[model samples]
Target: MALRTRAVLVHRRTELDELLDRHATRGQAEFFLRTRGRTLADVESRHEAAVSARRAVAASVPSDWALAEVERADLDRFLFAPEDVVLVVGQDGLVANAAKYLDRQLVVGVDPEPGTNLGVLVRHDADAVAGIIAALTNPPGRAGAAPSAVRCDELTMVRARLDDGQELRAVNELFLGHASHQSARYVLTVDGTAERQSSSGLIVSTGTGATGWSASIAHDRGGRRLPGPTEQALAWFVREAWPSPATGATLTEGMLGDDGELVVTVQSDRLVVFGDGMEGDRLEVSWGQEVRIGVAERRLRLV
Candidate 1:
């Protein structure tokens, strides 16, 4: 088929014609939920307004065509074929479900966060979403790729206590960074070595997170000024690219930094450490206890 399905954005303010233009060029159909900084609960009002403005828009489309922010439970509407992919045209905010799940293959992020593959982001107007959908239903090639990993009972989500007396949770990594400060200062101790830090903080991204926070700081942007094993070296190699190979390797505590100590320091006081990107743990932070961090074996699911 020559692609006829339509794709929808995250129900935010969007440029209709520009979106449609993508379709004109690509020969696909797309649409955006033109919004005005409305809350998830407020999409209904906006939808009503859109209906009043162009009743034909809704009438021509099926009743289940549009997805609302209030009830976004199923991915069935987006999933079509093994070759087809759906675009959840939205930003990372109150309306986004990226935080809710780690399905990068299905929910590709268009915007650039500290983590994530900005390269694959579907950054077009409403029309682009439609175009993508149209192109997907009758994709050009093979079905979805074979599975590499999935969730399991062996996999666990736990809440641990920081030396500073705060609790933290993680699925893949326990990343620490300056949310609003210039620097975050903390010592790194893998196994039993103490090393100081000069950067923002330490990061421990998982293999499951093949394209997230680990992807951002994976660059060797002069952090390796020191000589080889004598100076500080986090991993064996830091890719000049995003979503580097650092994701799938095992982090056996001895792979972080100087003498197995992954110390980190940012210029800011308001520091944050969490798994994925969702806020899990808050700590004042001090250097005393042997930070027991071990790379996890299992990963999670999304689509």
Candidate 2:
């Protein structure tokens, strides 16, 4: 049987929604913003634009295909099918967040406000969504079809797995660090060498995430530059590795090849692992737990 073309629309909360949640009412939110020298009209205008773009995209969906809309916070709970075409209608961060849960599905990043926001992942504007979706559902050489104007680029991802079977994937970077502002204790093993170390945290980053946290570390340390977004290798760095009698700071930075892996044994009582800057949603490991970080088998197909 042929695969069904189901469109899954993904979005995040608007600025107005967040403000209202904190203040409890529109009047209260406006008052709170006024105290900060900001106007409520600015928030309302941006919210209206986002809503309009969402409605326009919804109207453009094919009537014969299955359609589903999901919020960013509920992405982990939602079940994504293999044949689903995911449309992320938000910032670039949302695309990175959605990439973790997705398998091989084709994702199109749609920027609601093309004039105001600049996005690296969300390259397409709202006006081009209909054409992109139509081309994706029906490619060239098919009956009653023209050549597809849509193009897809594959991005590498990073994966982390615990010894007990829990795992997480990230399109940007994975942060293994202490739960609070303190030193994180762990045993780092890479390339047949193991060393005990205490540091601020560990960052395992994909090529796609090189421009973010990994880039900063590379610049400060004068280390090797990161790979491109489509490269298969990953860069690992230990942030502020502190040397001590019990913990050695050697083997703090290196590249992880396609077949290579980084093993970290948790010595801290409250060590957390999170990806794509979503620290609130993280995995906690106690002393003696082992976590392996490496390049993931799956890649993000961006259309």
Candidate 3:
């Protein structure tokens, strides 16, 4: 069967929209923010910009191609087609969120609020999306109006798989720890070495995540090194590992090559494994269960 190319637009609700939902009215939301020494004008302006950007993207979709829209909260429930071109119109974090549900589809990050956002993941301006779609639909050598070829950066991702047939993937990092952020007990095995340890949690980060949370840890450890965005290897860290009579912190950190794996056996009553900070949607590992994390088989094709 010939696969149809669909454009999936993923976004999140604006702060103004969220406030209105909580307060039930714009006036109430404004008053609430005013009490905190804030105003609604900035929020409203950003909201309008986001709406305009989305409208522009929607209007630029090719007439023959299928289009679908999904909010951040509904991403887990949304079904993505195999031949889809996913467009994330939000911050870098939103790109990480949508990357979990995708496979081989090409992803384009659209920054709705240009100057405010870092544009690390949402790298394209709102007006450039039409050209991107045109170039994608009409690759080089094809008879079309596309002026240039779009460059795709295949970014690596991390995967966590539990013994119970559950799995998750992320563009940033995978966090395995207690749900309450308390001390977690587990047996960690990496690079052929094994040890029982108790700590806050474990963070397995990819090159893409090196600039975020993992970077902080690296900075703390006398500027310990991490991988680059396209690097095949990944870095793992055991947060605040405490040595005790029954546990050791010797195996607190290391790197995993393309063929390497990190296994953790749950010693606590239960532990949670979430990717890209989405703790709500996670895998639960019970006593004695082993959770293996490694480089994911699929890489994110970001345009």
On TM-score, the stronger of 1 and 2 is 2
TM per candidate: 0.35, 0.94, 0.95
Give the better candidate number (1 or 3) by TM-score.
3
* Model 1 accuracy (lDDT, Cα): 0.35
Each model's lDDT comes to 0.35, 0.87, 0.89
Q: Candidate 1: which stretches are off by over 4 Å?
A: 1-160, 164-166, 221-271, 279-281, 286-291, 296-303
Would you list the clashing residue pairs of candidate 3? Answer: none
- Stretches > 4 Å off in candidate 2: 138-149
- Top model number, lDDT: 3
| Per-residue lDDT of candidate 3, residues 1-303 (tens digit) | 345568899999999999999999989999999999989998899999999989989888898788999999999999987678888999999999999998867889999987667466778987899989878753333322223388888899999988988889999999999999799999998878899999999999999999998999988887878998989989999999999999999987889999999999999987999988888889888999999999999988888
User: How many clashing residue pairs appear in each of the predictions shown?
Assistant: 20, 0, 0
Which of candidates 1 and 3 is the stronger one according to lDDT?
Answer: 3
Please report how far candidate 3 places residue 238 from its true position, in Å: 0.6
Q: Give the TM-score of candidate 1.
A: 0.35
Cα error of candidate 2 at position 61, Å: 1.1
Q: How close is candidate 2 to the true structure, as a TM-score?
A: 0.94
